[model samples]
Target: MNTPADRATRVQDIVTVFLLSITAVLTAWCGFESSKWGGEMSIAFSQASSARVQAAAAAGEARDARQFDLQIYTQWVVATADEREQLAAYVEDRFPERLKVAFDAWVDGGMAEDSPLVVDAYVAPGDAEAADLTARADGKFQEALENNQRGDNYSLLTVMFALVLFLGAMSQRDITRWVSRTLLGLGVVVALVGIGLLTTFPIKI
Candidate 1:
């Protein structure tokens, strides 16, 4: 009843079950990780897209501001004393009242080349806000790129899980111990790689 062949067969069965159980666990873990990464990627993409749209709107506003700057320069170049005063009034009306001090200084200096109004130092607050949005959009795009890469890494891990499941299943069917062992070993190697990737790939949940 306790024959060596029966005992050996039982041992093989136990080993097969162990391998299958381990492979199933690994597959489940990989599937969950892939899902988590995918979700993060979507969120990142949405943020990036929203930032891009806001940045575009800000850039458009900046273009309008730049056009106004050009108009002011043109008026200053051609205006008589009365027209120059009118141009100054127009600039005051175009921007917030807070900028009057800077505007007055710029005009008192004869609108010289070194005028602070020509640069961001005295430029409208809206223009500065637009510039900030452009920089923010670039930063969002970079984050989206990094998240996409992390999603790809998790996707690759899912593929590796497939292989592990396949090879481990094959080990259950192979008649020779060496063949079964080899297949199981290959699965282990793939699982190891997936595990290593898990350590490096970014994830939140």
Candidate 2:
């Protein structure tokens, strides 16, 4: 034998409890996803840093190898210009394998290029490997940034859910029925919007 007002109050209480429960679960899920994405971001950043260091080392090796090749090639040029055939031969014989291949190609091409350094075949020892590692580092860095953004999105959603929870709690307080209903309505709207946004975000285990 409940009056209409009593029945309405009971309905409000039920709606508030439902909203609070659902909002709490969603907030927890958002927090968990944010943490997972943060961990993924950290791992990606670490991998990126490791790759960068290895790339730098490899690039340094390539630079040093190229410098050595340049010095040997200069010696060969000077000996050849002075018509010192034996000295030129000695320098040529000691050319690094990469340089020797390019030198041979240059000679076969009637010495058309200014130097074997310009030849396509003259790749420094670690040049290709360094380039590959650098690309890998760049890719990992970009991935880390994307992961960080995803974590931020989840954090924002967690805040949104928290707001919904607040609204739901306020709705359950002793206030005017209309005001209570308004707060509950707002909480429901916010929760729906949050769920929509959450669906758009990627999930990370």
Candidate 3:
């Protein structure tokens, strides 16, 4: 009862179903990984920025406060020295510890990020090394941002592929048309859920 065109259509429909299934699964997995990766990248940058700010604040407070007098301001000088040491430890140790894992993860995934080592930033101020590290961090943040965007795109494509497959699988009859439309609607809803996650999940560095 089937013509050549009908047979070809049926074969194409089968292929569509397989492609859609594969794409849908991949999209879901990729989207989840992207979200988690972006969040970790953002946290790393934020902690670095905080460490930098704390160091600068300590330096500025030491410079402005009186340190020559030992009568009443001796406590201030001691506090300033303590603050400087704390700042050094934070930049050289704490920040690096926080970012080491995320940086390694990115690199192992065949992507690289700015080093979190704060040796130059703390040991030698106003140098090229500090500038380079900051610039590298910004680049890494942008890379993570792009990855998140790519995830959204892939998810949308998967939904479109699913709709095409559903339509191809349906007959031209009224009941089949209704079923196809329902499936397409569900696809759209799932895709929108993905979009919501893409926007809401924190990626800001």
Candidate 4:
């Protein structure tokens, strides 16, 4: 014949088993999510690095193009000041399409206020592309930081679930009934809190 104490002990054992099992699964899930978010962060960082390199390359190209255009414009200016029409025409013919547009606009404006280099139409090659690539790199860097924070959040939940597992295992000891029940109750409370926090995190996989 099972006494009331035996029945209560049996019930406590069942609840402890259930709590341990559920908390173990939740712990594993948190670890998995943390790993996934870490991978995402690495990938985002790599993409940001690649974009930064490309942006730097584009900026270098723009600088070189601008310098070449300046050299050509200086030659043209010297030829024009010396009244060498043929030399000026020769240098003007060699102007890149980008510089030619600005030069034509400057000439049309009576060459009064600003030089071709300062003209609105004087966009060096790769300038816009470099600016766009830089913006993309900045965005990717921000995304990487966000991913890292998400991974950290999941890691914290994993630690919380581990504490719950510890408490649930301790409840199975040969302690007094009330003490065992208290440990089990604490474990359940911790597990519930961890689950609530888990719900708020973004899922990566």
* Clashes within 3 Å, all models in order: 0, 0, 0, 0
lDDT of 1 by residue, 49-118 (tens): 7876876787677677657666665565455455677865665566534345566667677767554356
**What is candidate 4's CA lDDT for residue 184?**
92
Per-residue lDDT of model 3, residues 78-109, tens digit only: 54467876644444343233243443454465
Where model 1 places Cα greater than 4 Å from the true spot, the runs are: 1-12, 81-117
In order of appearance, the predictions have TM-scores of: 0.75, 0.95, 0.37, 0.92
Cα-based lDDT at residue 81, candidate 3: 67
Better of 2 and 4 by lDDT: 2
Residue 168, candidate 1: Cα error in Å is 1.3
Where does the lowest 10-residue lDDT sum fall in candidate 1? 92-101
Per-residue lDDT for 22-129 in model 4, tens only?
A: 999998999999999999999999999999999999999999999999999999999999999999999999999999999998889888745898888789888999
Which residue pairs show backbone clashes in model 3? none
Report the C-alpha displacement of residue 111, candidate 4, in angstroms: 4.3
Candidate 3 lDDT for residue 168: 38
Best by TM-score: 2
State residue 116's C-alpha deviation in candidate 4, in Å: 1.8
